[model samples]
Target: MTDIKDLPKKSGPSGGWGSMKGIKRIHAESHADPAAFDTLRRQNKPGGFMCSSCAFPKPANYKPFEFCENGAKATLWEQTRDRCTPEFWEHHTVESLKDWTDHELESTGRLTAPMRYDAATDRYVEVTWDEAFQGIAATLNRLPADDVVFYSSGHAGLEASYLYALLARLHGTNNLPQSSNMCHETTSVGLKKVIGSPVGTVIWDDIDATDCYFFFGQNPGTNSPRFLHWLKELKDRGGKIVTFNPVREQGLISFVNPQSPVDMATGRETVISDQYHQVRAGGDVAAILGMCKAVIEVDDEAARTGGELVIDHDFIAEHTTGFDTFIDFARRTHWSDIEHHSGLAEADLRAAAAVYMEHDRVIGVYGMGLTQHAHGALNIAMLVNFLCLRGNIGKTGAGVCPIRGHSNVQGQRTVGIAEKAGLVPMDKLRELFGFEPPQEDGTHIVDAVEGLIDGRIKGFVSLGGNLARAVPDQKRMEAAWARQELTVMISTKLNRSHLFPGRDAYILPCLSRAEIDEQATGNQVITVEDSFSHIHGSTGKRTPASPKLKSELEIVARIGKASLPPNPKVRWDDWIGDYGLVRDLIEATYPDDFRDFNERMFEPGGFWRGVPARDRIWKTESGKAEITTPPQLTSLGYGEKDGRYRLITMRSNDQFNTTIYGYSDRFRGIEGTRDVLLMNQMDMAELNLIKGDKVAMVSDYDDGEDRRLGGLSVIPFDLPRGTVGSYYPECNVLIAISHHDELSKTPASKSVPVRIERDGLAQS
Candidate 1:
């Protein structure tokens, strides 16, 4: 591989940070082989492997090389020739690997064996599959069902997630905390309260059909590249794209689709957003409230003129309740307060309101930036209010679009991976498996971590994911992992999670989605649901990295077999032998949308699950859309009295959730480093800090807990006053587990209160 700086910068959407630069470097370091491209293309064809990155929907009718840069990187990453064998483990101990960077750990390549950590040697030693399974089962069986927590990453396929949920339920524990709990739990919780559904109501085609697209706290370029194509098309058709974010993303400014030969040859880029407004961090609710207030203003004016303008009077009267209360609240909110809170000009808010008034249908799209804050759930509720004001829900080309991160995270939840006991498909599970599923409420991600720290959870089993790095408060998280009696990780590659060894740690390598999974029945194709609720097939095309590595299905099944006695109560082996059997169980368990899982997945674009609110048929207890009030804004002032700067955590374009691809965030002008913090020029000027000044950030929590992360290079940039942005996981040390969403329990990652000071200074 070539050096990160030596790589030629690819002209595309903005937000190519650390790993993005490394990916471009890799592309430039080597030429694409036609044979390799063709093989990858063939493998990526519909009905084959799902894109291992974002869950952006692909048109069922279209069959083009439509994959994005990140998708290509994900594909090439798994296709690499690297390997991590028993010899590699013999050379490096767990303590030694802990010193390695995240990129270095994963770049070592795939794990080639089932390994168990030997406490004495402090190194991973190869173990037989039976012995590993027996050990895992023994540990799990020793703990109370509630004491064993099961965590799943979104990377797992629908088959694997379903099997995982089944395993957890079969063990009589509802402790299934998934990746969605950390990311989109706000969307799920907020939408369920208002619209009676968790997933986005809009489809890919809805972008082209809508008159207005409202983007909130999402950077499409780096996060969901595939959505850019639709945004480009929407712009070409003169449809309005309005953006609300803290930073001005390059993708939102203009994007040149590399796939379009004509546009690429002409060096022409399509402008995306018609209107862009920068809402300060933790200001999404205020911004959304401003929008709703403007709508109300327009409605009142239209009423005075004896006209029907933006307000959907008929739909509101028939489909929604609490309009009077919502209007009253909106009328009471002062515009000055909205402007101050939103950091948006009153004219801009009114302009956006005019667009909302002119458009018949509007769609609101959001990502983690909107959902990972103190008022995340409220932000979601306010967006719903914006849509509800225009009667956009349950309609074509209009609704809430929560762009999920993991490909199968939403699907996993759909297949009974939730903590809420009432949400479980109990009747179906009982009828199909002849065993009553657990009806007790389970712990979410935050709850699970707390349980671990509190000594309530003894055993940990992860079907797929890097839990240690993904969770907040890295020091506490690592300590919690160490406290666990036993920890089992079923994954495709080596990650930071493996380094934090438990009393008994077992790492089971699994097959990637790109690899062929041939079972006793036949070759199987797993299914995945995208952000838009479209389910499709994902069948691996390449051979396993190593024959010893088992598929997630196989590992989960083996563990289940070892843990549970053979009985006709559940067809665990049958489902394991054939992925279709698992799908069959899913179909039986959730007959509403997945009646014919196998047959439907084989269809052109699979099937879109039912979204009740799409038809304005809200399943809320009130039988209508609920109008929620925004929480009172309590000022959480930044910086300490010692003249330290406030630190906000963020992701580089090149990185995914916690997996670091490489160092260099091109859009942010950062290169060869992840330990740098982006600071405002004015803030630095006031603090007498220079661009290359070294600093250490510490938490400003009242408690005297030392939450300091040292060795950061301050880079002066265009940012909000008294605000500083640093890469996550590194800055995660500054955020405590206690600093989370009050309602959703999502860590306030975007709004951490920290104080940055000169490297060795007790007080700068």
Candidate 2:
């Protein structure tokens, strides 16, 4: 048997897809000059496209060439020389395309024309733009507005999202399911309940001013490398960072900023977190409760001795309610239980609490790692409770930051893409659009899939996103898509979702951010909101990949005009023809911060929407930040038997959410493949599993009968016991649709129970 220690070491450049096996894949293709690429990445330029990779906020001051490795790859991938015209589709059948790997299908390059599925040949055939739009309009007009679902991706611009929201509302449907429904929906739900806002309160500058940084379930190195700049500054000034995650991500340990030439030349990597703890999977809620318990215990001791150990007793006494209830729960929580569940000693937790008590200002940042659990919403609520106990919500350098994945995902929600029950925004939409939008409370991404399988939904119109691949249960999702009567996709490049064609399907080619868009008006500038809530103007610098392609705004506008009855009151076509006019309408429709969208976006460094929390103004019902009670300690519902493990899905360092940049995870020492699973040495030994052993993981849920995803190679590492990790999208099949947060409807992608056996072996 091969020992894990003898496994080959993965080698590659320090950052981005430089470590990917397909490093030369783009270089092999014929591309334009580097100067043109540099010109597109410039700040204050009209065409500075938001990085399609992650939702890292663009720096206030722009660099000459600020594109990251993954961002450059996404740009080149969208603006490649390769073309998939009618002839290419003629050669490949839908069945054949189905067999092709995701990387192979995408690498085939950009689609140059609109295409419709040809049932006769089982392949897509080229269609005219007018014919495609007319067919879509006909189907949309036939269906009840509630039956039609409009899904948006984070890759879209603010202008495009605004147009999409308007079109959906104008058409009388509030069924706008976005990428946020799958990722940060829990953050939005939990934060709103606690602080009256869904977005994070921290800014880039806040990181530097904070005395302590607490990161939960986030790996900044791979997920958001741009954060390293702020962490480095914090470390330089003697500030400390604390990290809590199930896996010891390399990014949390050390990061060598690729943007810093001197650091890169010197090969010096800055240590990020001063202390790191690997909490057990699905243990974030417990870990946070443990910390709060320690704080309360210290306060009790201080009160008995006539000394002050608690940080913000006055803030808690005056501002919060239900404190006695929260304290009762905290005092009842046992140290042994906390230690066992969190996989950390009580001493470590107390040490962390000490740092929080000593520091006057602290910031807590998190990502999907916390929100992908069954108790994800509860985890976020507990984090909020901890912060409010210290009056950290509305203070400089102290707040909660939920790092969003898509570039404009947070912005999409901010501009009214939610299905929140009885939300005031939906009522506002009715006042603006005349028609009372469906108030039945529409479906989220998971519910949408269930609706698709249950035959409640018939039509799907996606603005931008690989929806089929992005959601869990890929096989089931693909089958459901096949059942749809009409499925329309507006995409910039070919992806897995395009291949999941309906009986009547259309793939409309669209313009990318890097491409110059010449609309009916001479030229256009689009707006985008970053993770930090900064709205900025972006223009296209390069030529459009094809004359056949149209901007997302144009396609949605045309569809709205074609589907809706002629209403002279709302000039849909005019707005579609001119994007700035759409921005003006948005400014008027939602007049809180964007009074003059066009003028504010023109200024350098863009403009910030008002964040009342940043100024210590709590928008909660009581006009004070609320303290939440800790979650009840119940059995995690995992019947831990011999040889059972909890498998958590994760993104590779080189990859973004679902888009596979390349099949290598550099930090984990994985290469040339994403087919391996990370396991703890103790678990592997107890299960009698050796390194390189082929294993099959079956879901523990009875409803997940078809959820037996297998053929994974086992790789033992320093992960926590009873926990395993694998790449997402591939492992998404193992997660059952029913396994989701009840409040937010987000899939529990981080906490899936499974029993692994040797390949082709039956359960013991």
Candidate 3:
């Protein structure tokens, strides 16, 4: 008999009983353990570690219950009472455990000690920490420097990622890639080209100041629920919340403040979106062009009629350049093309523009929806253009917020975890750490995966990430590991990647962000930067789950010492023992940015790593804001939309990236299972598909390989016609690695062309 998932018939407001159930699920998952409760309390308290969930920065003033629903799940996932001991591995071989789901693997529990692969036994047996480190070093030292790829995860805090990148550079390769490559690389690359900084221009307070805003390609309700509170507050304060996406997310439609017991009990949900437009996948650039054209036309008409012009002429003329060129290009971009591609009417575009032009301050925000496409960078640049038209950037309630995926993903890049070799100057690195950092650009996730597949890269070192599952082409990437000489993971728990061991594999168990990390110096306090560039310190105060587990800092330092030739002059030991020295060195390298990094850590609310773009200090090559031409229709096309449908992969409310916390998406009304596809009702009707119709999606690309996902049932959704949605990692298999944004190299995970056919045997 087939597994019938508990599909909730009715979808309601995001944050009422549904959120309560999520909170309950978290508590129940932890088995109502007092330690989990205590751990959360301590983690949320002042002077405690920041939540390692999504990168929504914590408020400066601490709250006893600052964590969100997913935050609780994240902590519970890390601090679970379950333990994976050596004896546990003896019972389940890696070959046997290979079929287990990603959730099952992580749920196996935190590793109690280091483990090494046993070829004959096909199991990972316990090994000494020294052996793990030495073995990692030996493997890397033996391989060609470029053959080793170092990947970083968002869950990895700022300090750990920094040290991880440094160790990789010390090992003499720039083959460093991280979560940024998969999510916000477009934001960084695009913004840096114009604004001179690859970061969001707005701080948290800007949310309150803006009177009107649009979230293009973002649904904070599921990805960032805590952000929904802010969105609710914006609406409560008479601010307009406009949304543009292929699927009209329920969270954007309305929300009930989970923290407000009165609203939660009364079943009162506040309306969130003033305007919602269902733009198709890869249609964002066209939509943005339409908006700009509308604003320009309005200004032109107002000028001719002797009415007040709506454009922020002063801000545009003084703070930015190339506006006239942008206007010319936007005018040249035809309304019909935009309408055809975006599935939006000119009237709707003008109405949204009316809202934008009426407001003096507007904050524009976006996520992976904009960044994971062929013209992703252009999509981001065009967004900056929208804000620039109204003088929004660097204003009180006006700026760009590139909503990042991981808590410290932005923070890692801040402290020096870059794939580009010279990101941290070799002169500066040698002056501080006494080593010549390589000068060639390194492999990002896509390049790393390609290298691994082609046998060019034989060793892979990941700092707490499920790379095999997270990347596109799941089967190919997973099998590519077999060709590797060695694979090492410095992580707290076992994941899908661990099960796919290479010839030589090691699991170096490290402490999570929730546990107390006592170094030789004392209890170490690590710093993490938020999406908005606020740097804060997080000190995990709970007792370690296993005394055998070492801090991420310790693991990196040990590996560095063993891997690199002895250089007593470089205080790797001191930096490892005391993070303050590391911060001091960071300040030494980035004197202006981290002037008083150590002292700032003690600030009541974290200090800001100010963006020059927000301050009107242009850092671009032109010394002013630069604008790009509106994307050509070719860059925004999805072949012929006859029988093929545009697919957009998203995260379920119960999931975070590849980490599947649960099977249900409470927000989307899908429950108890992930083996379902969310297709537009019209599309489903056209295909004669019904709910629970077993089908397999076939990729439209002629990639020689038959890329397909079989036995997925179709479920109707409120999405644009010819567009469909499914949770990522599950759908990641359909996206070809070659299908990526040319500029940022980010996988076009959000938009993939596919066609679905009913599975006869499965239906039978």
Best by lDDT: 3
Q: Which tens-of-lDDT digit does each residue in 439-503 have in candidate 3?
A: 88988888888888888889888888888888888889989986789988887777888888999
TM-score of 1: 0.94
Between the candidate structures 2 and 3, which one is better when assessed by TM-score? Answer: 3
Which residue pairs collide in model 1, if any?
16-666, 17-664, 17-665, 17-666, 18-664, 18-665, 20-654, 394-614, 645-756
Taken over the whole model, the C-alpha lDDT of each candidate is 0.78, 0.76, 0.81
Cα TM-score of candidate 3: 0.96
| Residues 491-561 of candidate 1: C-alpha lDDT, one tens digit per residue | 76789999988898999998888777888887778888888888988777677779897888889888998
> Pick by TM-score: which candidate is best?
3
**Per-residue alpha-carbon lDDT of candidate 2 for residues 278-382, written as tens digits (9 for 90 to 100):** 788877777888889988888899989999767487877766666789988889888898887778888888878877888888888998888887768888888
Order of the predicted models by lDDT, top scorer first: 3, 1, 2
Q: Backbone clashes per model, in order?
A: 9, 2, 1
Single out the weakest 10-residue window by summed lDDT for candidate 1.
1-10
Give all TM-scores, in the order shown: 0.94, 0.94, 0.96
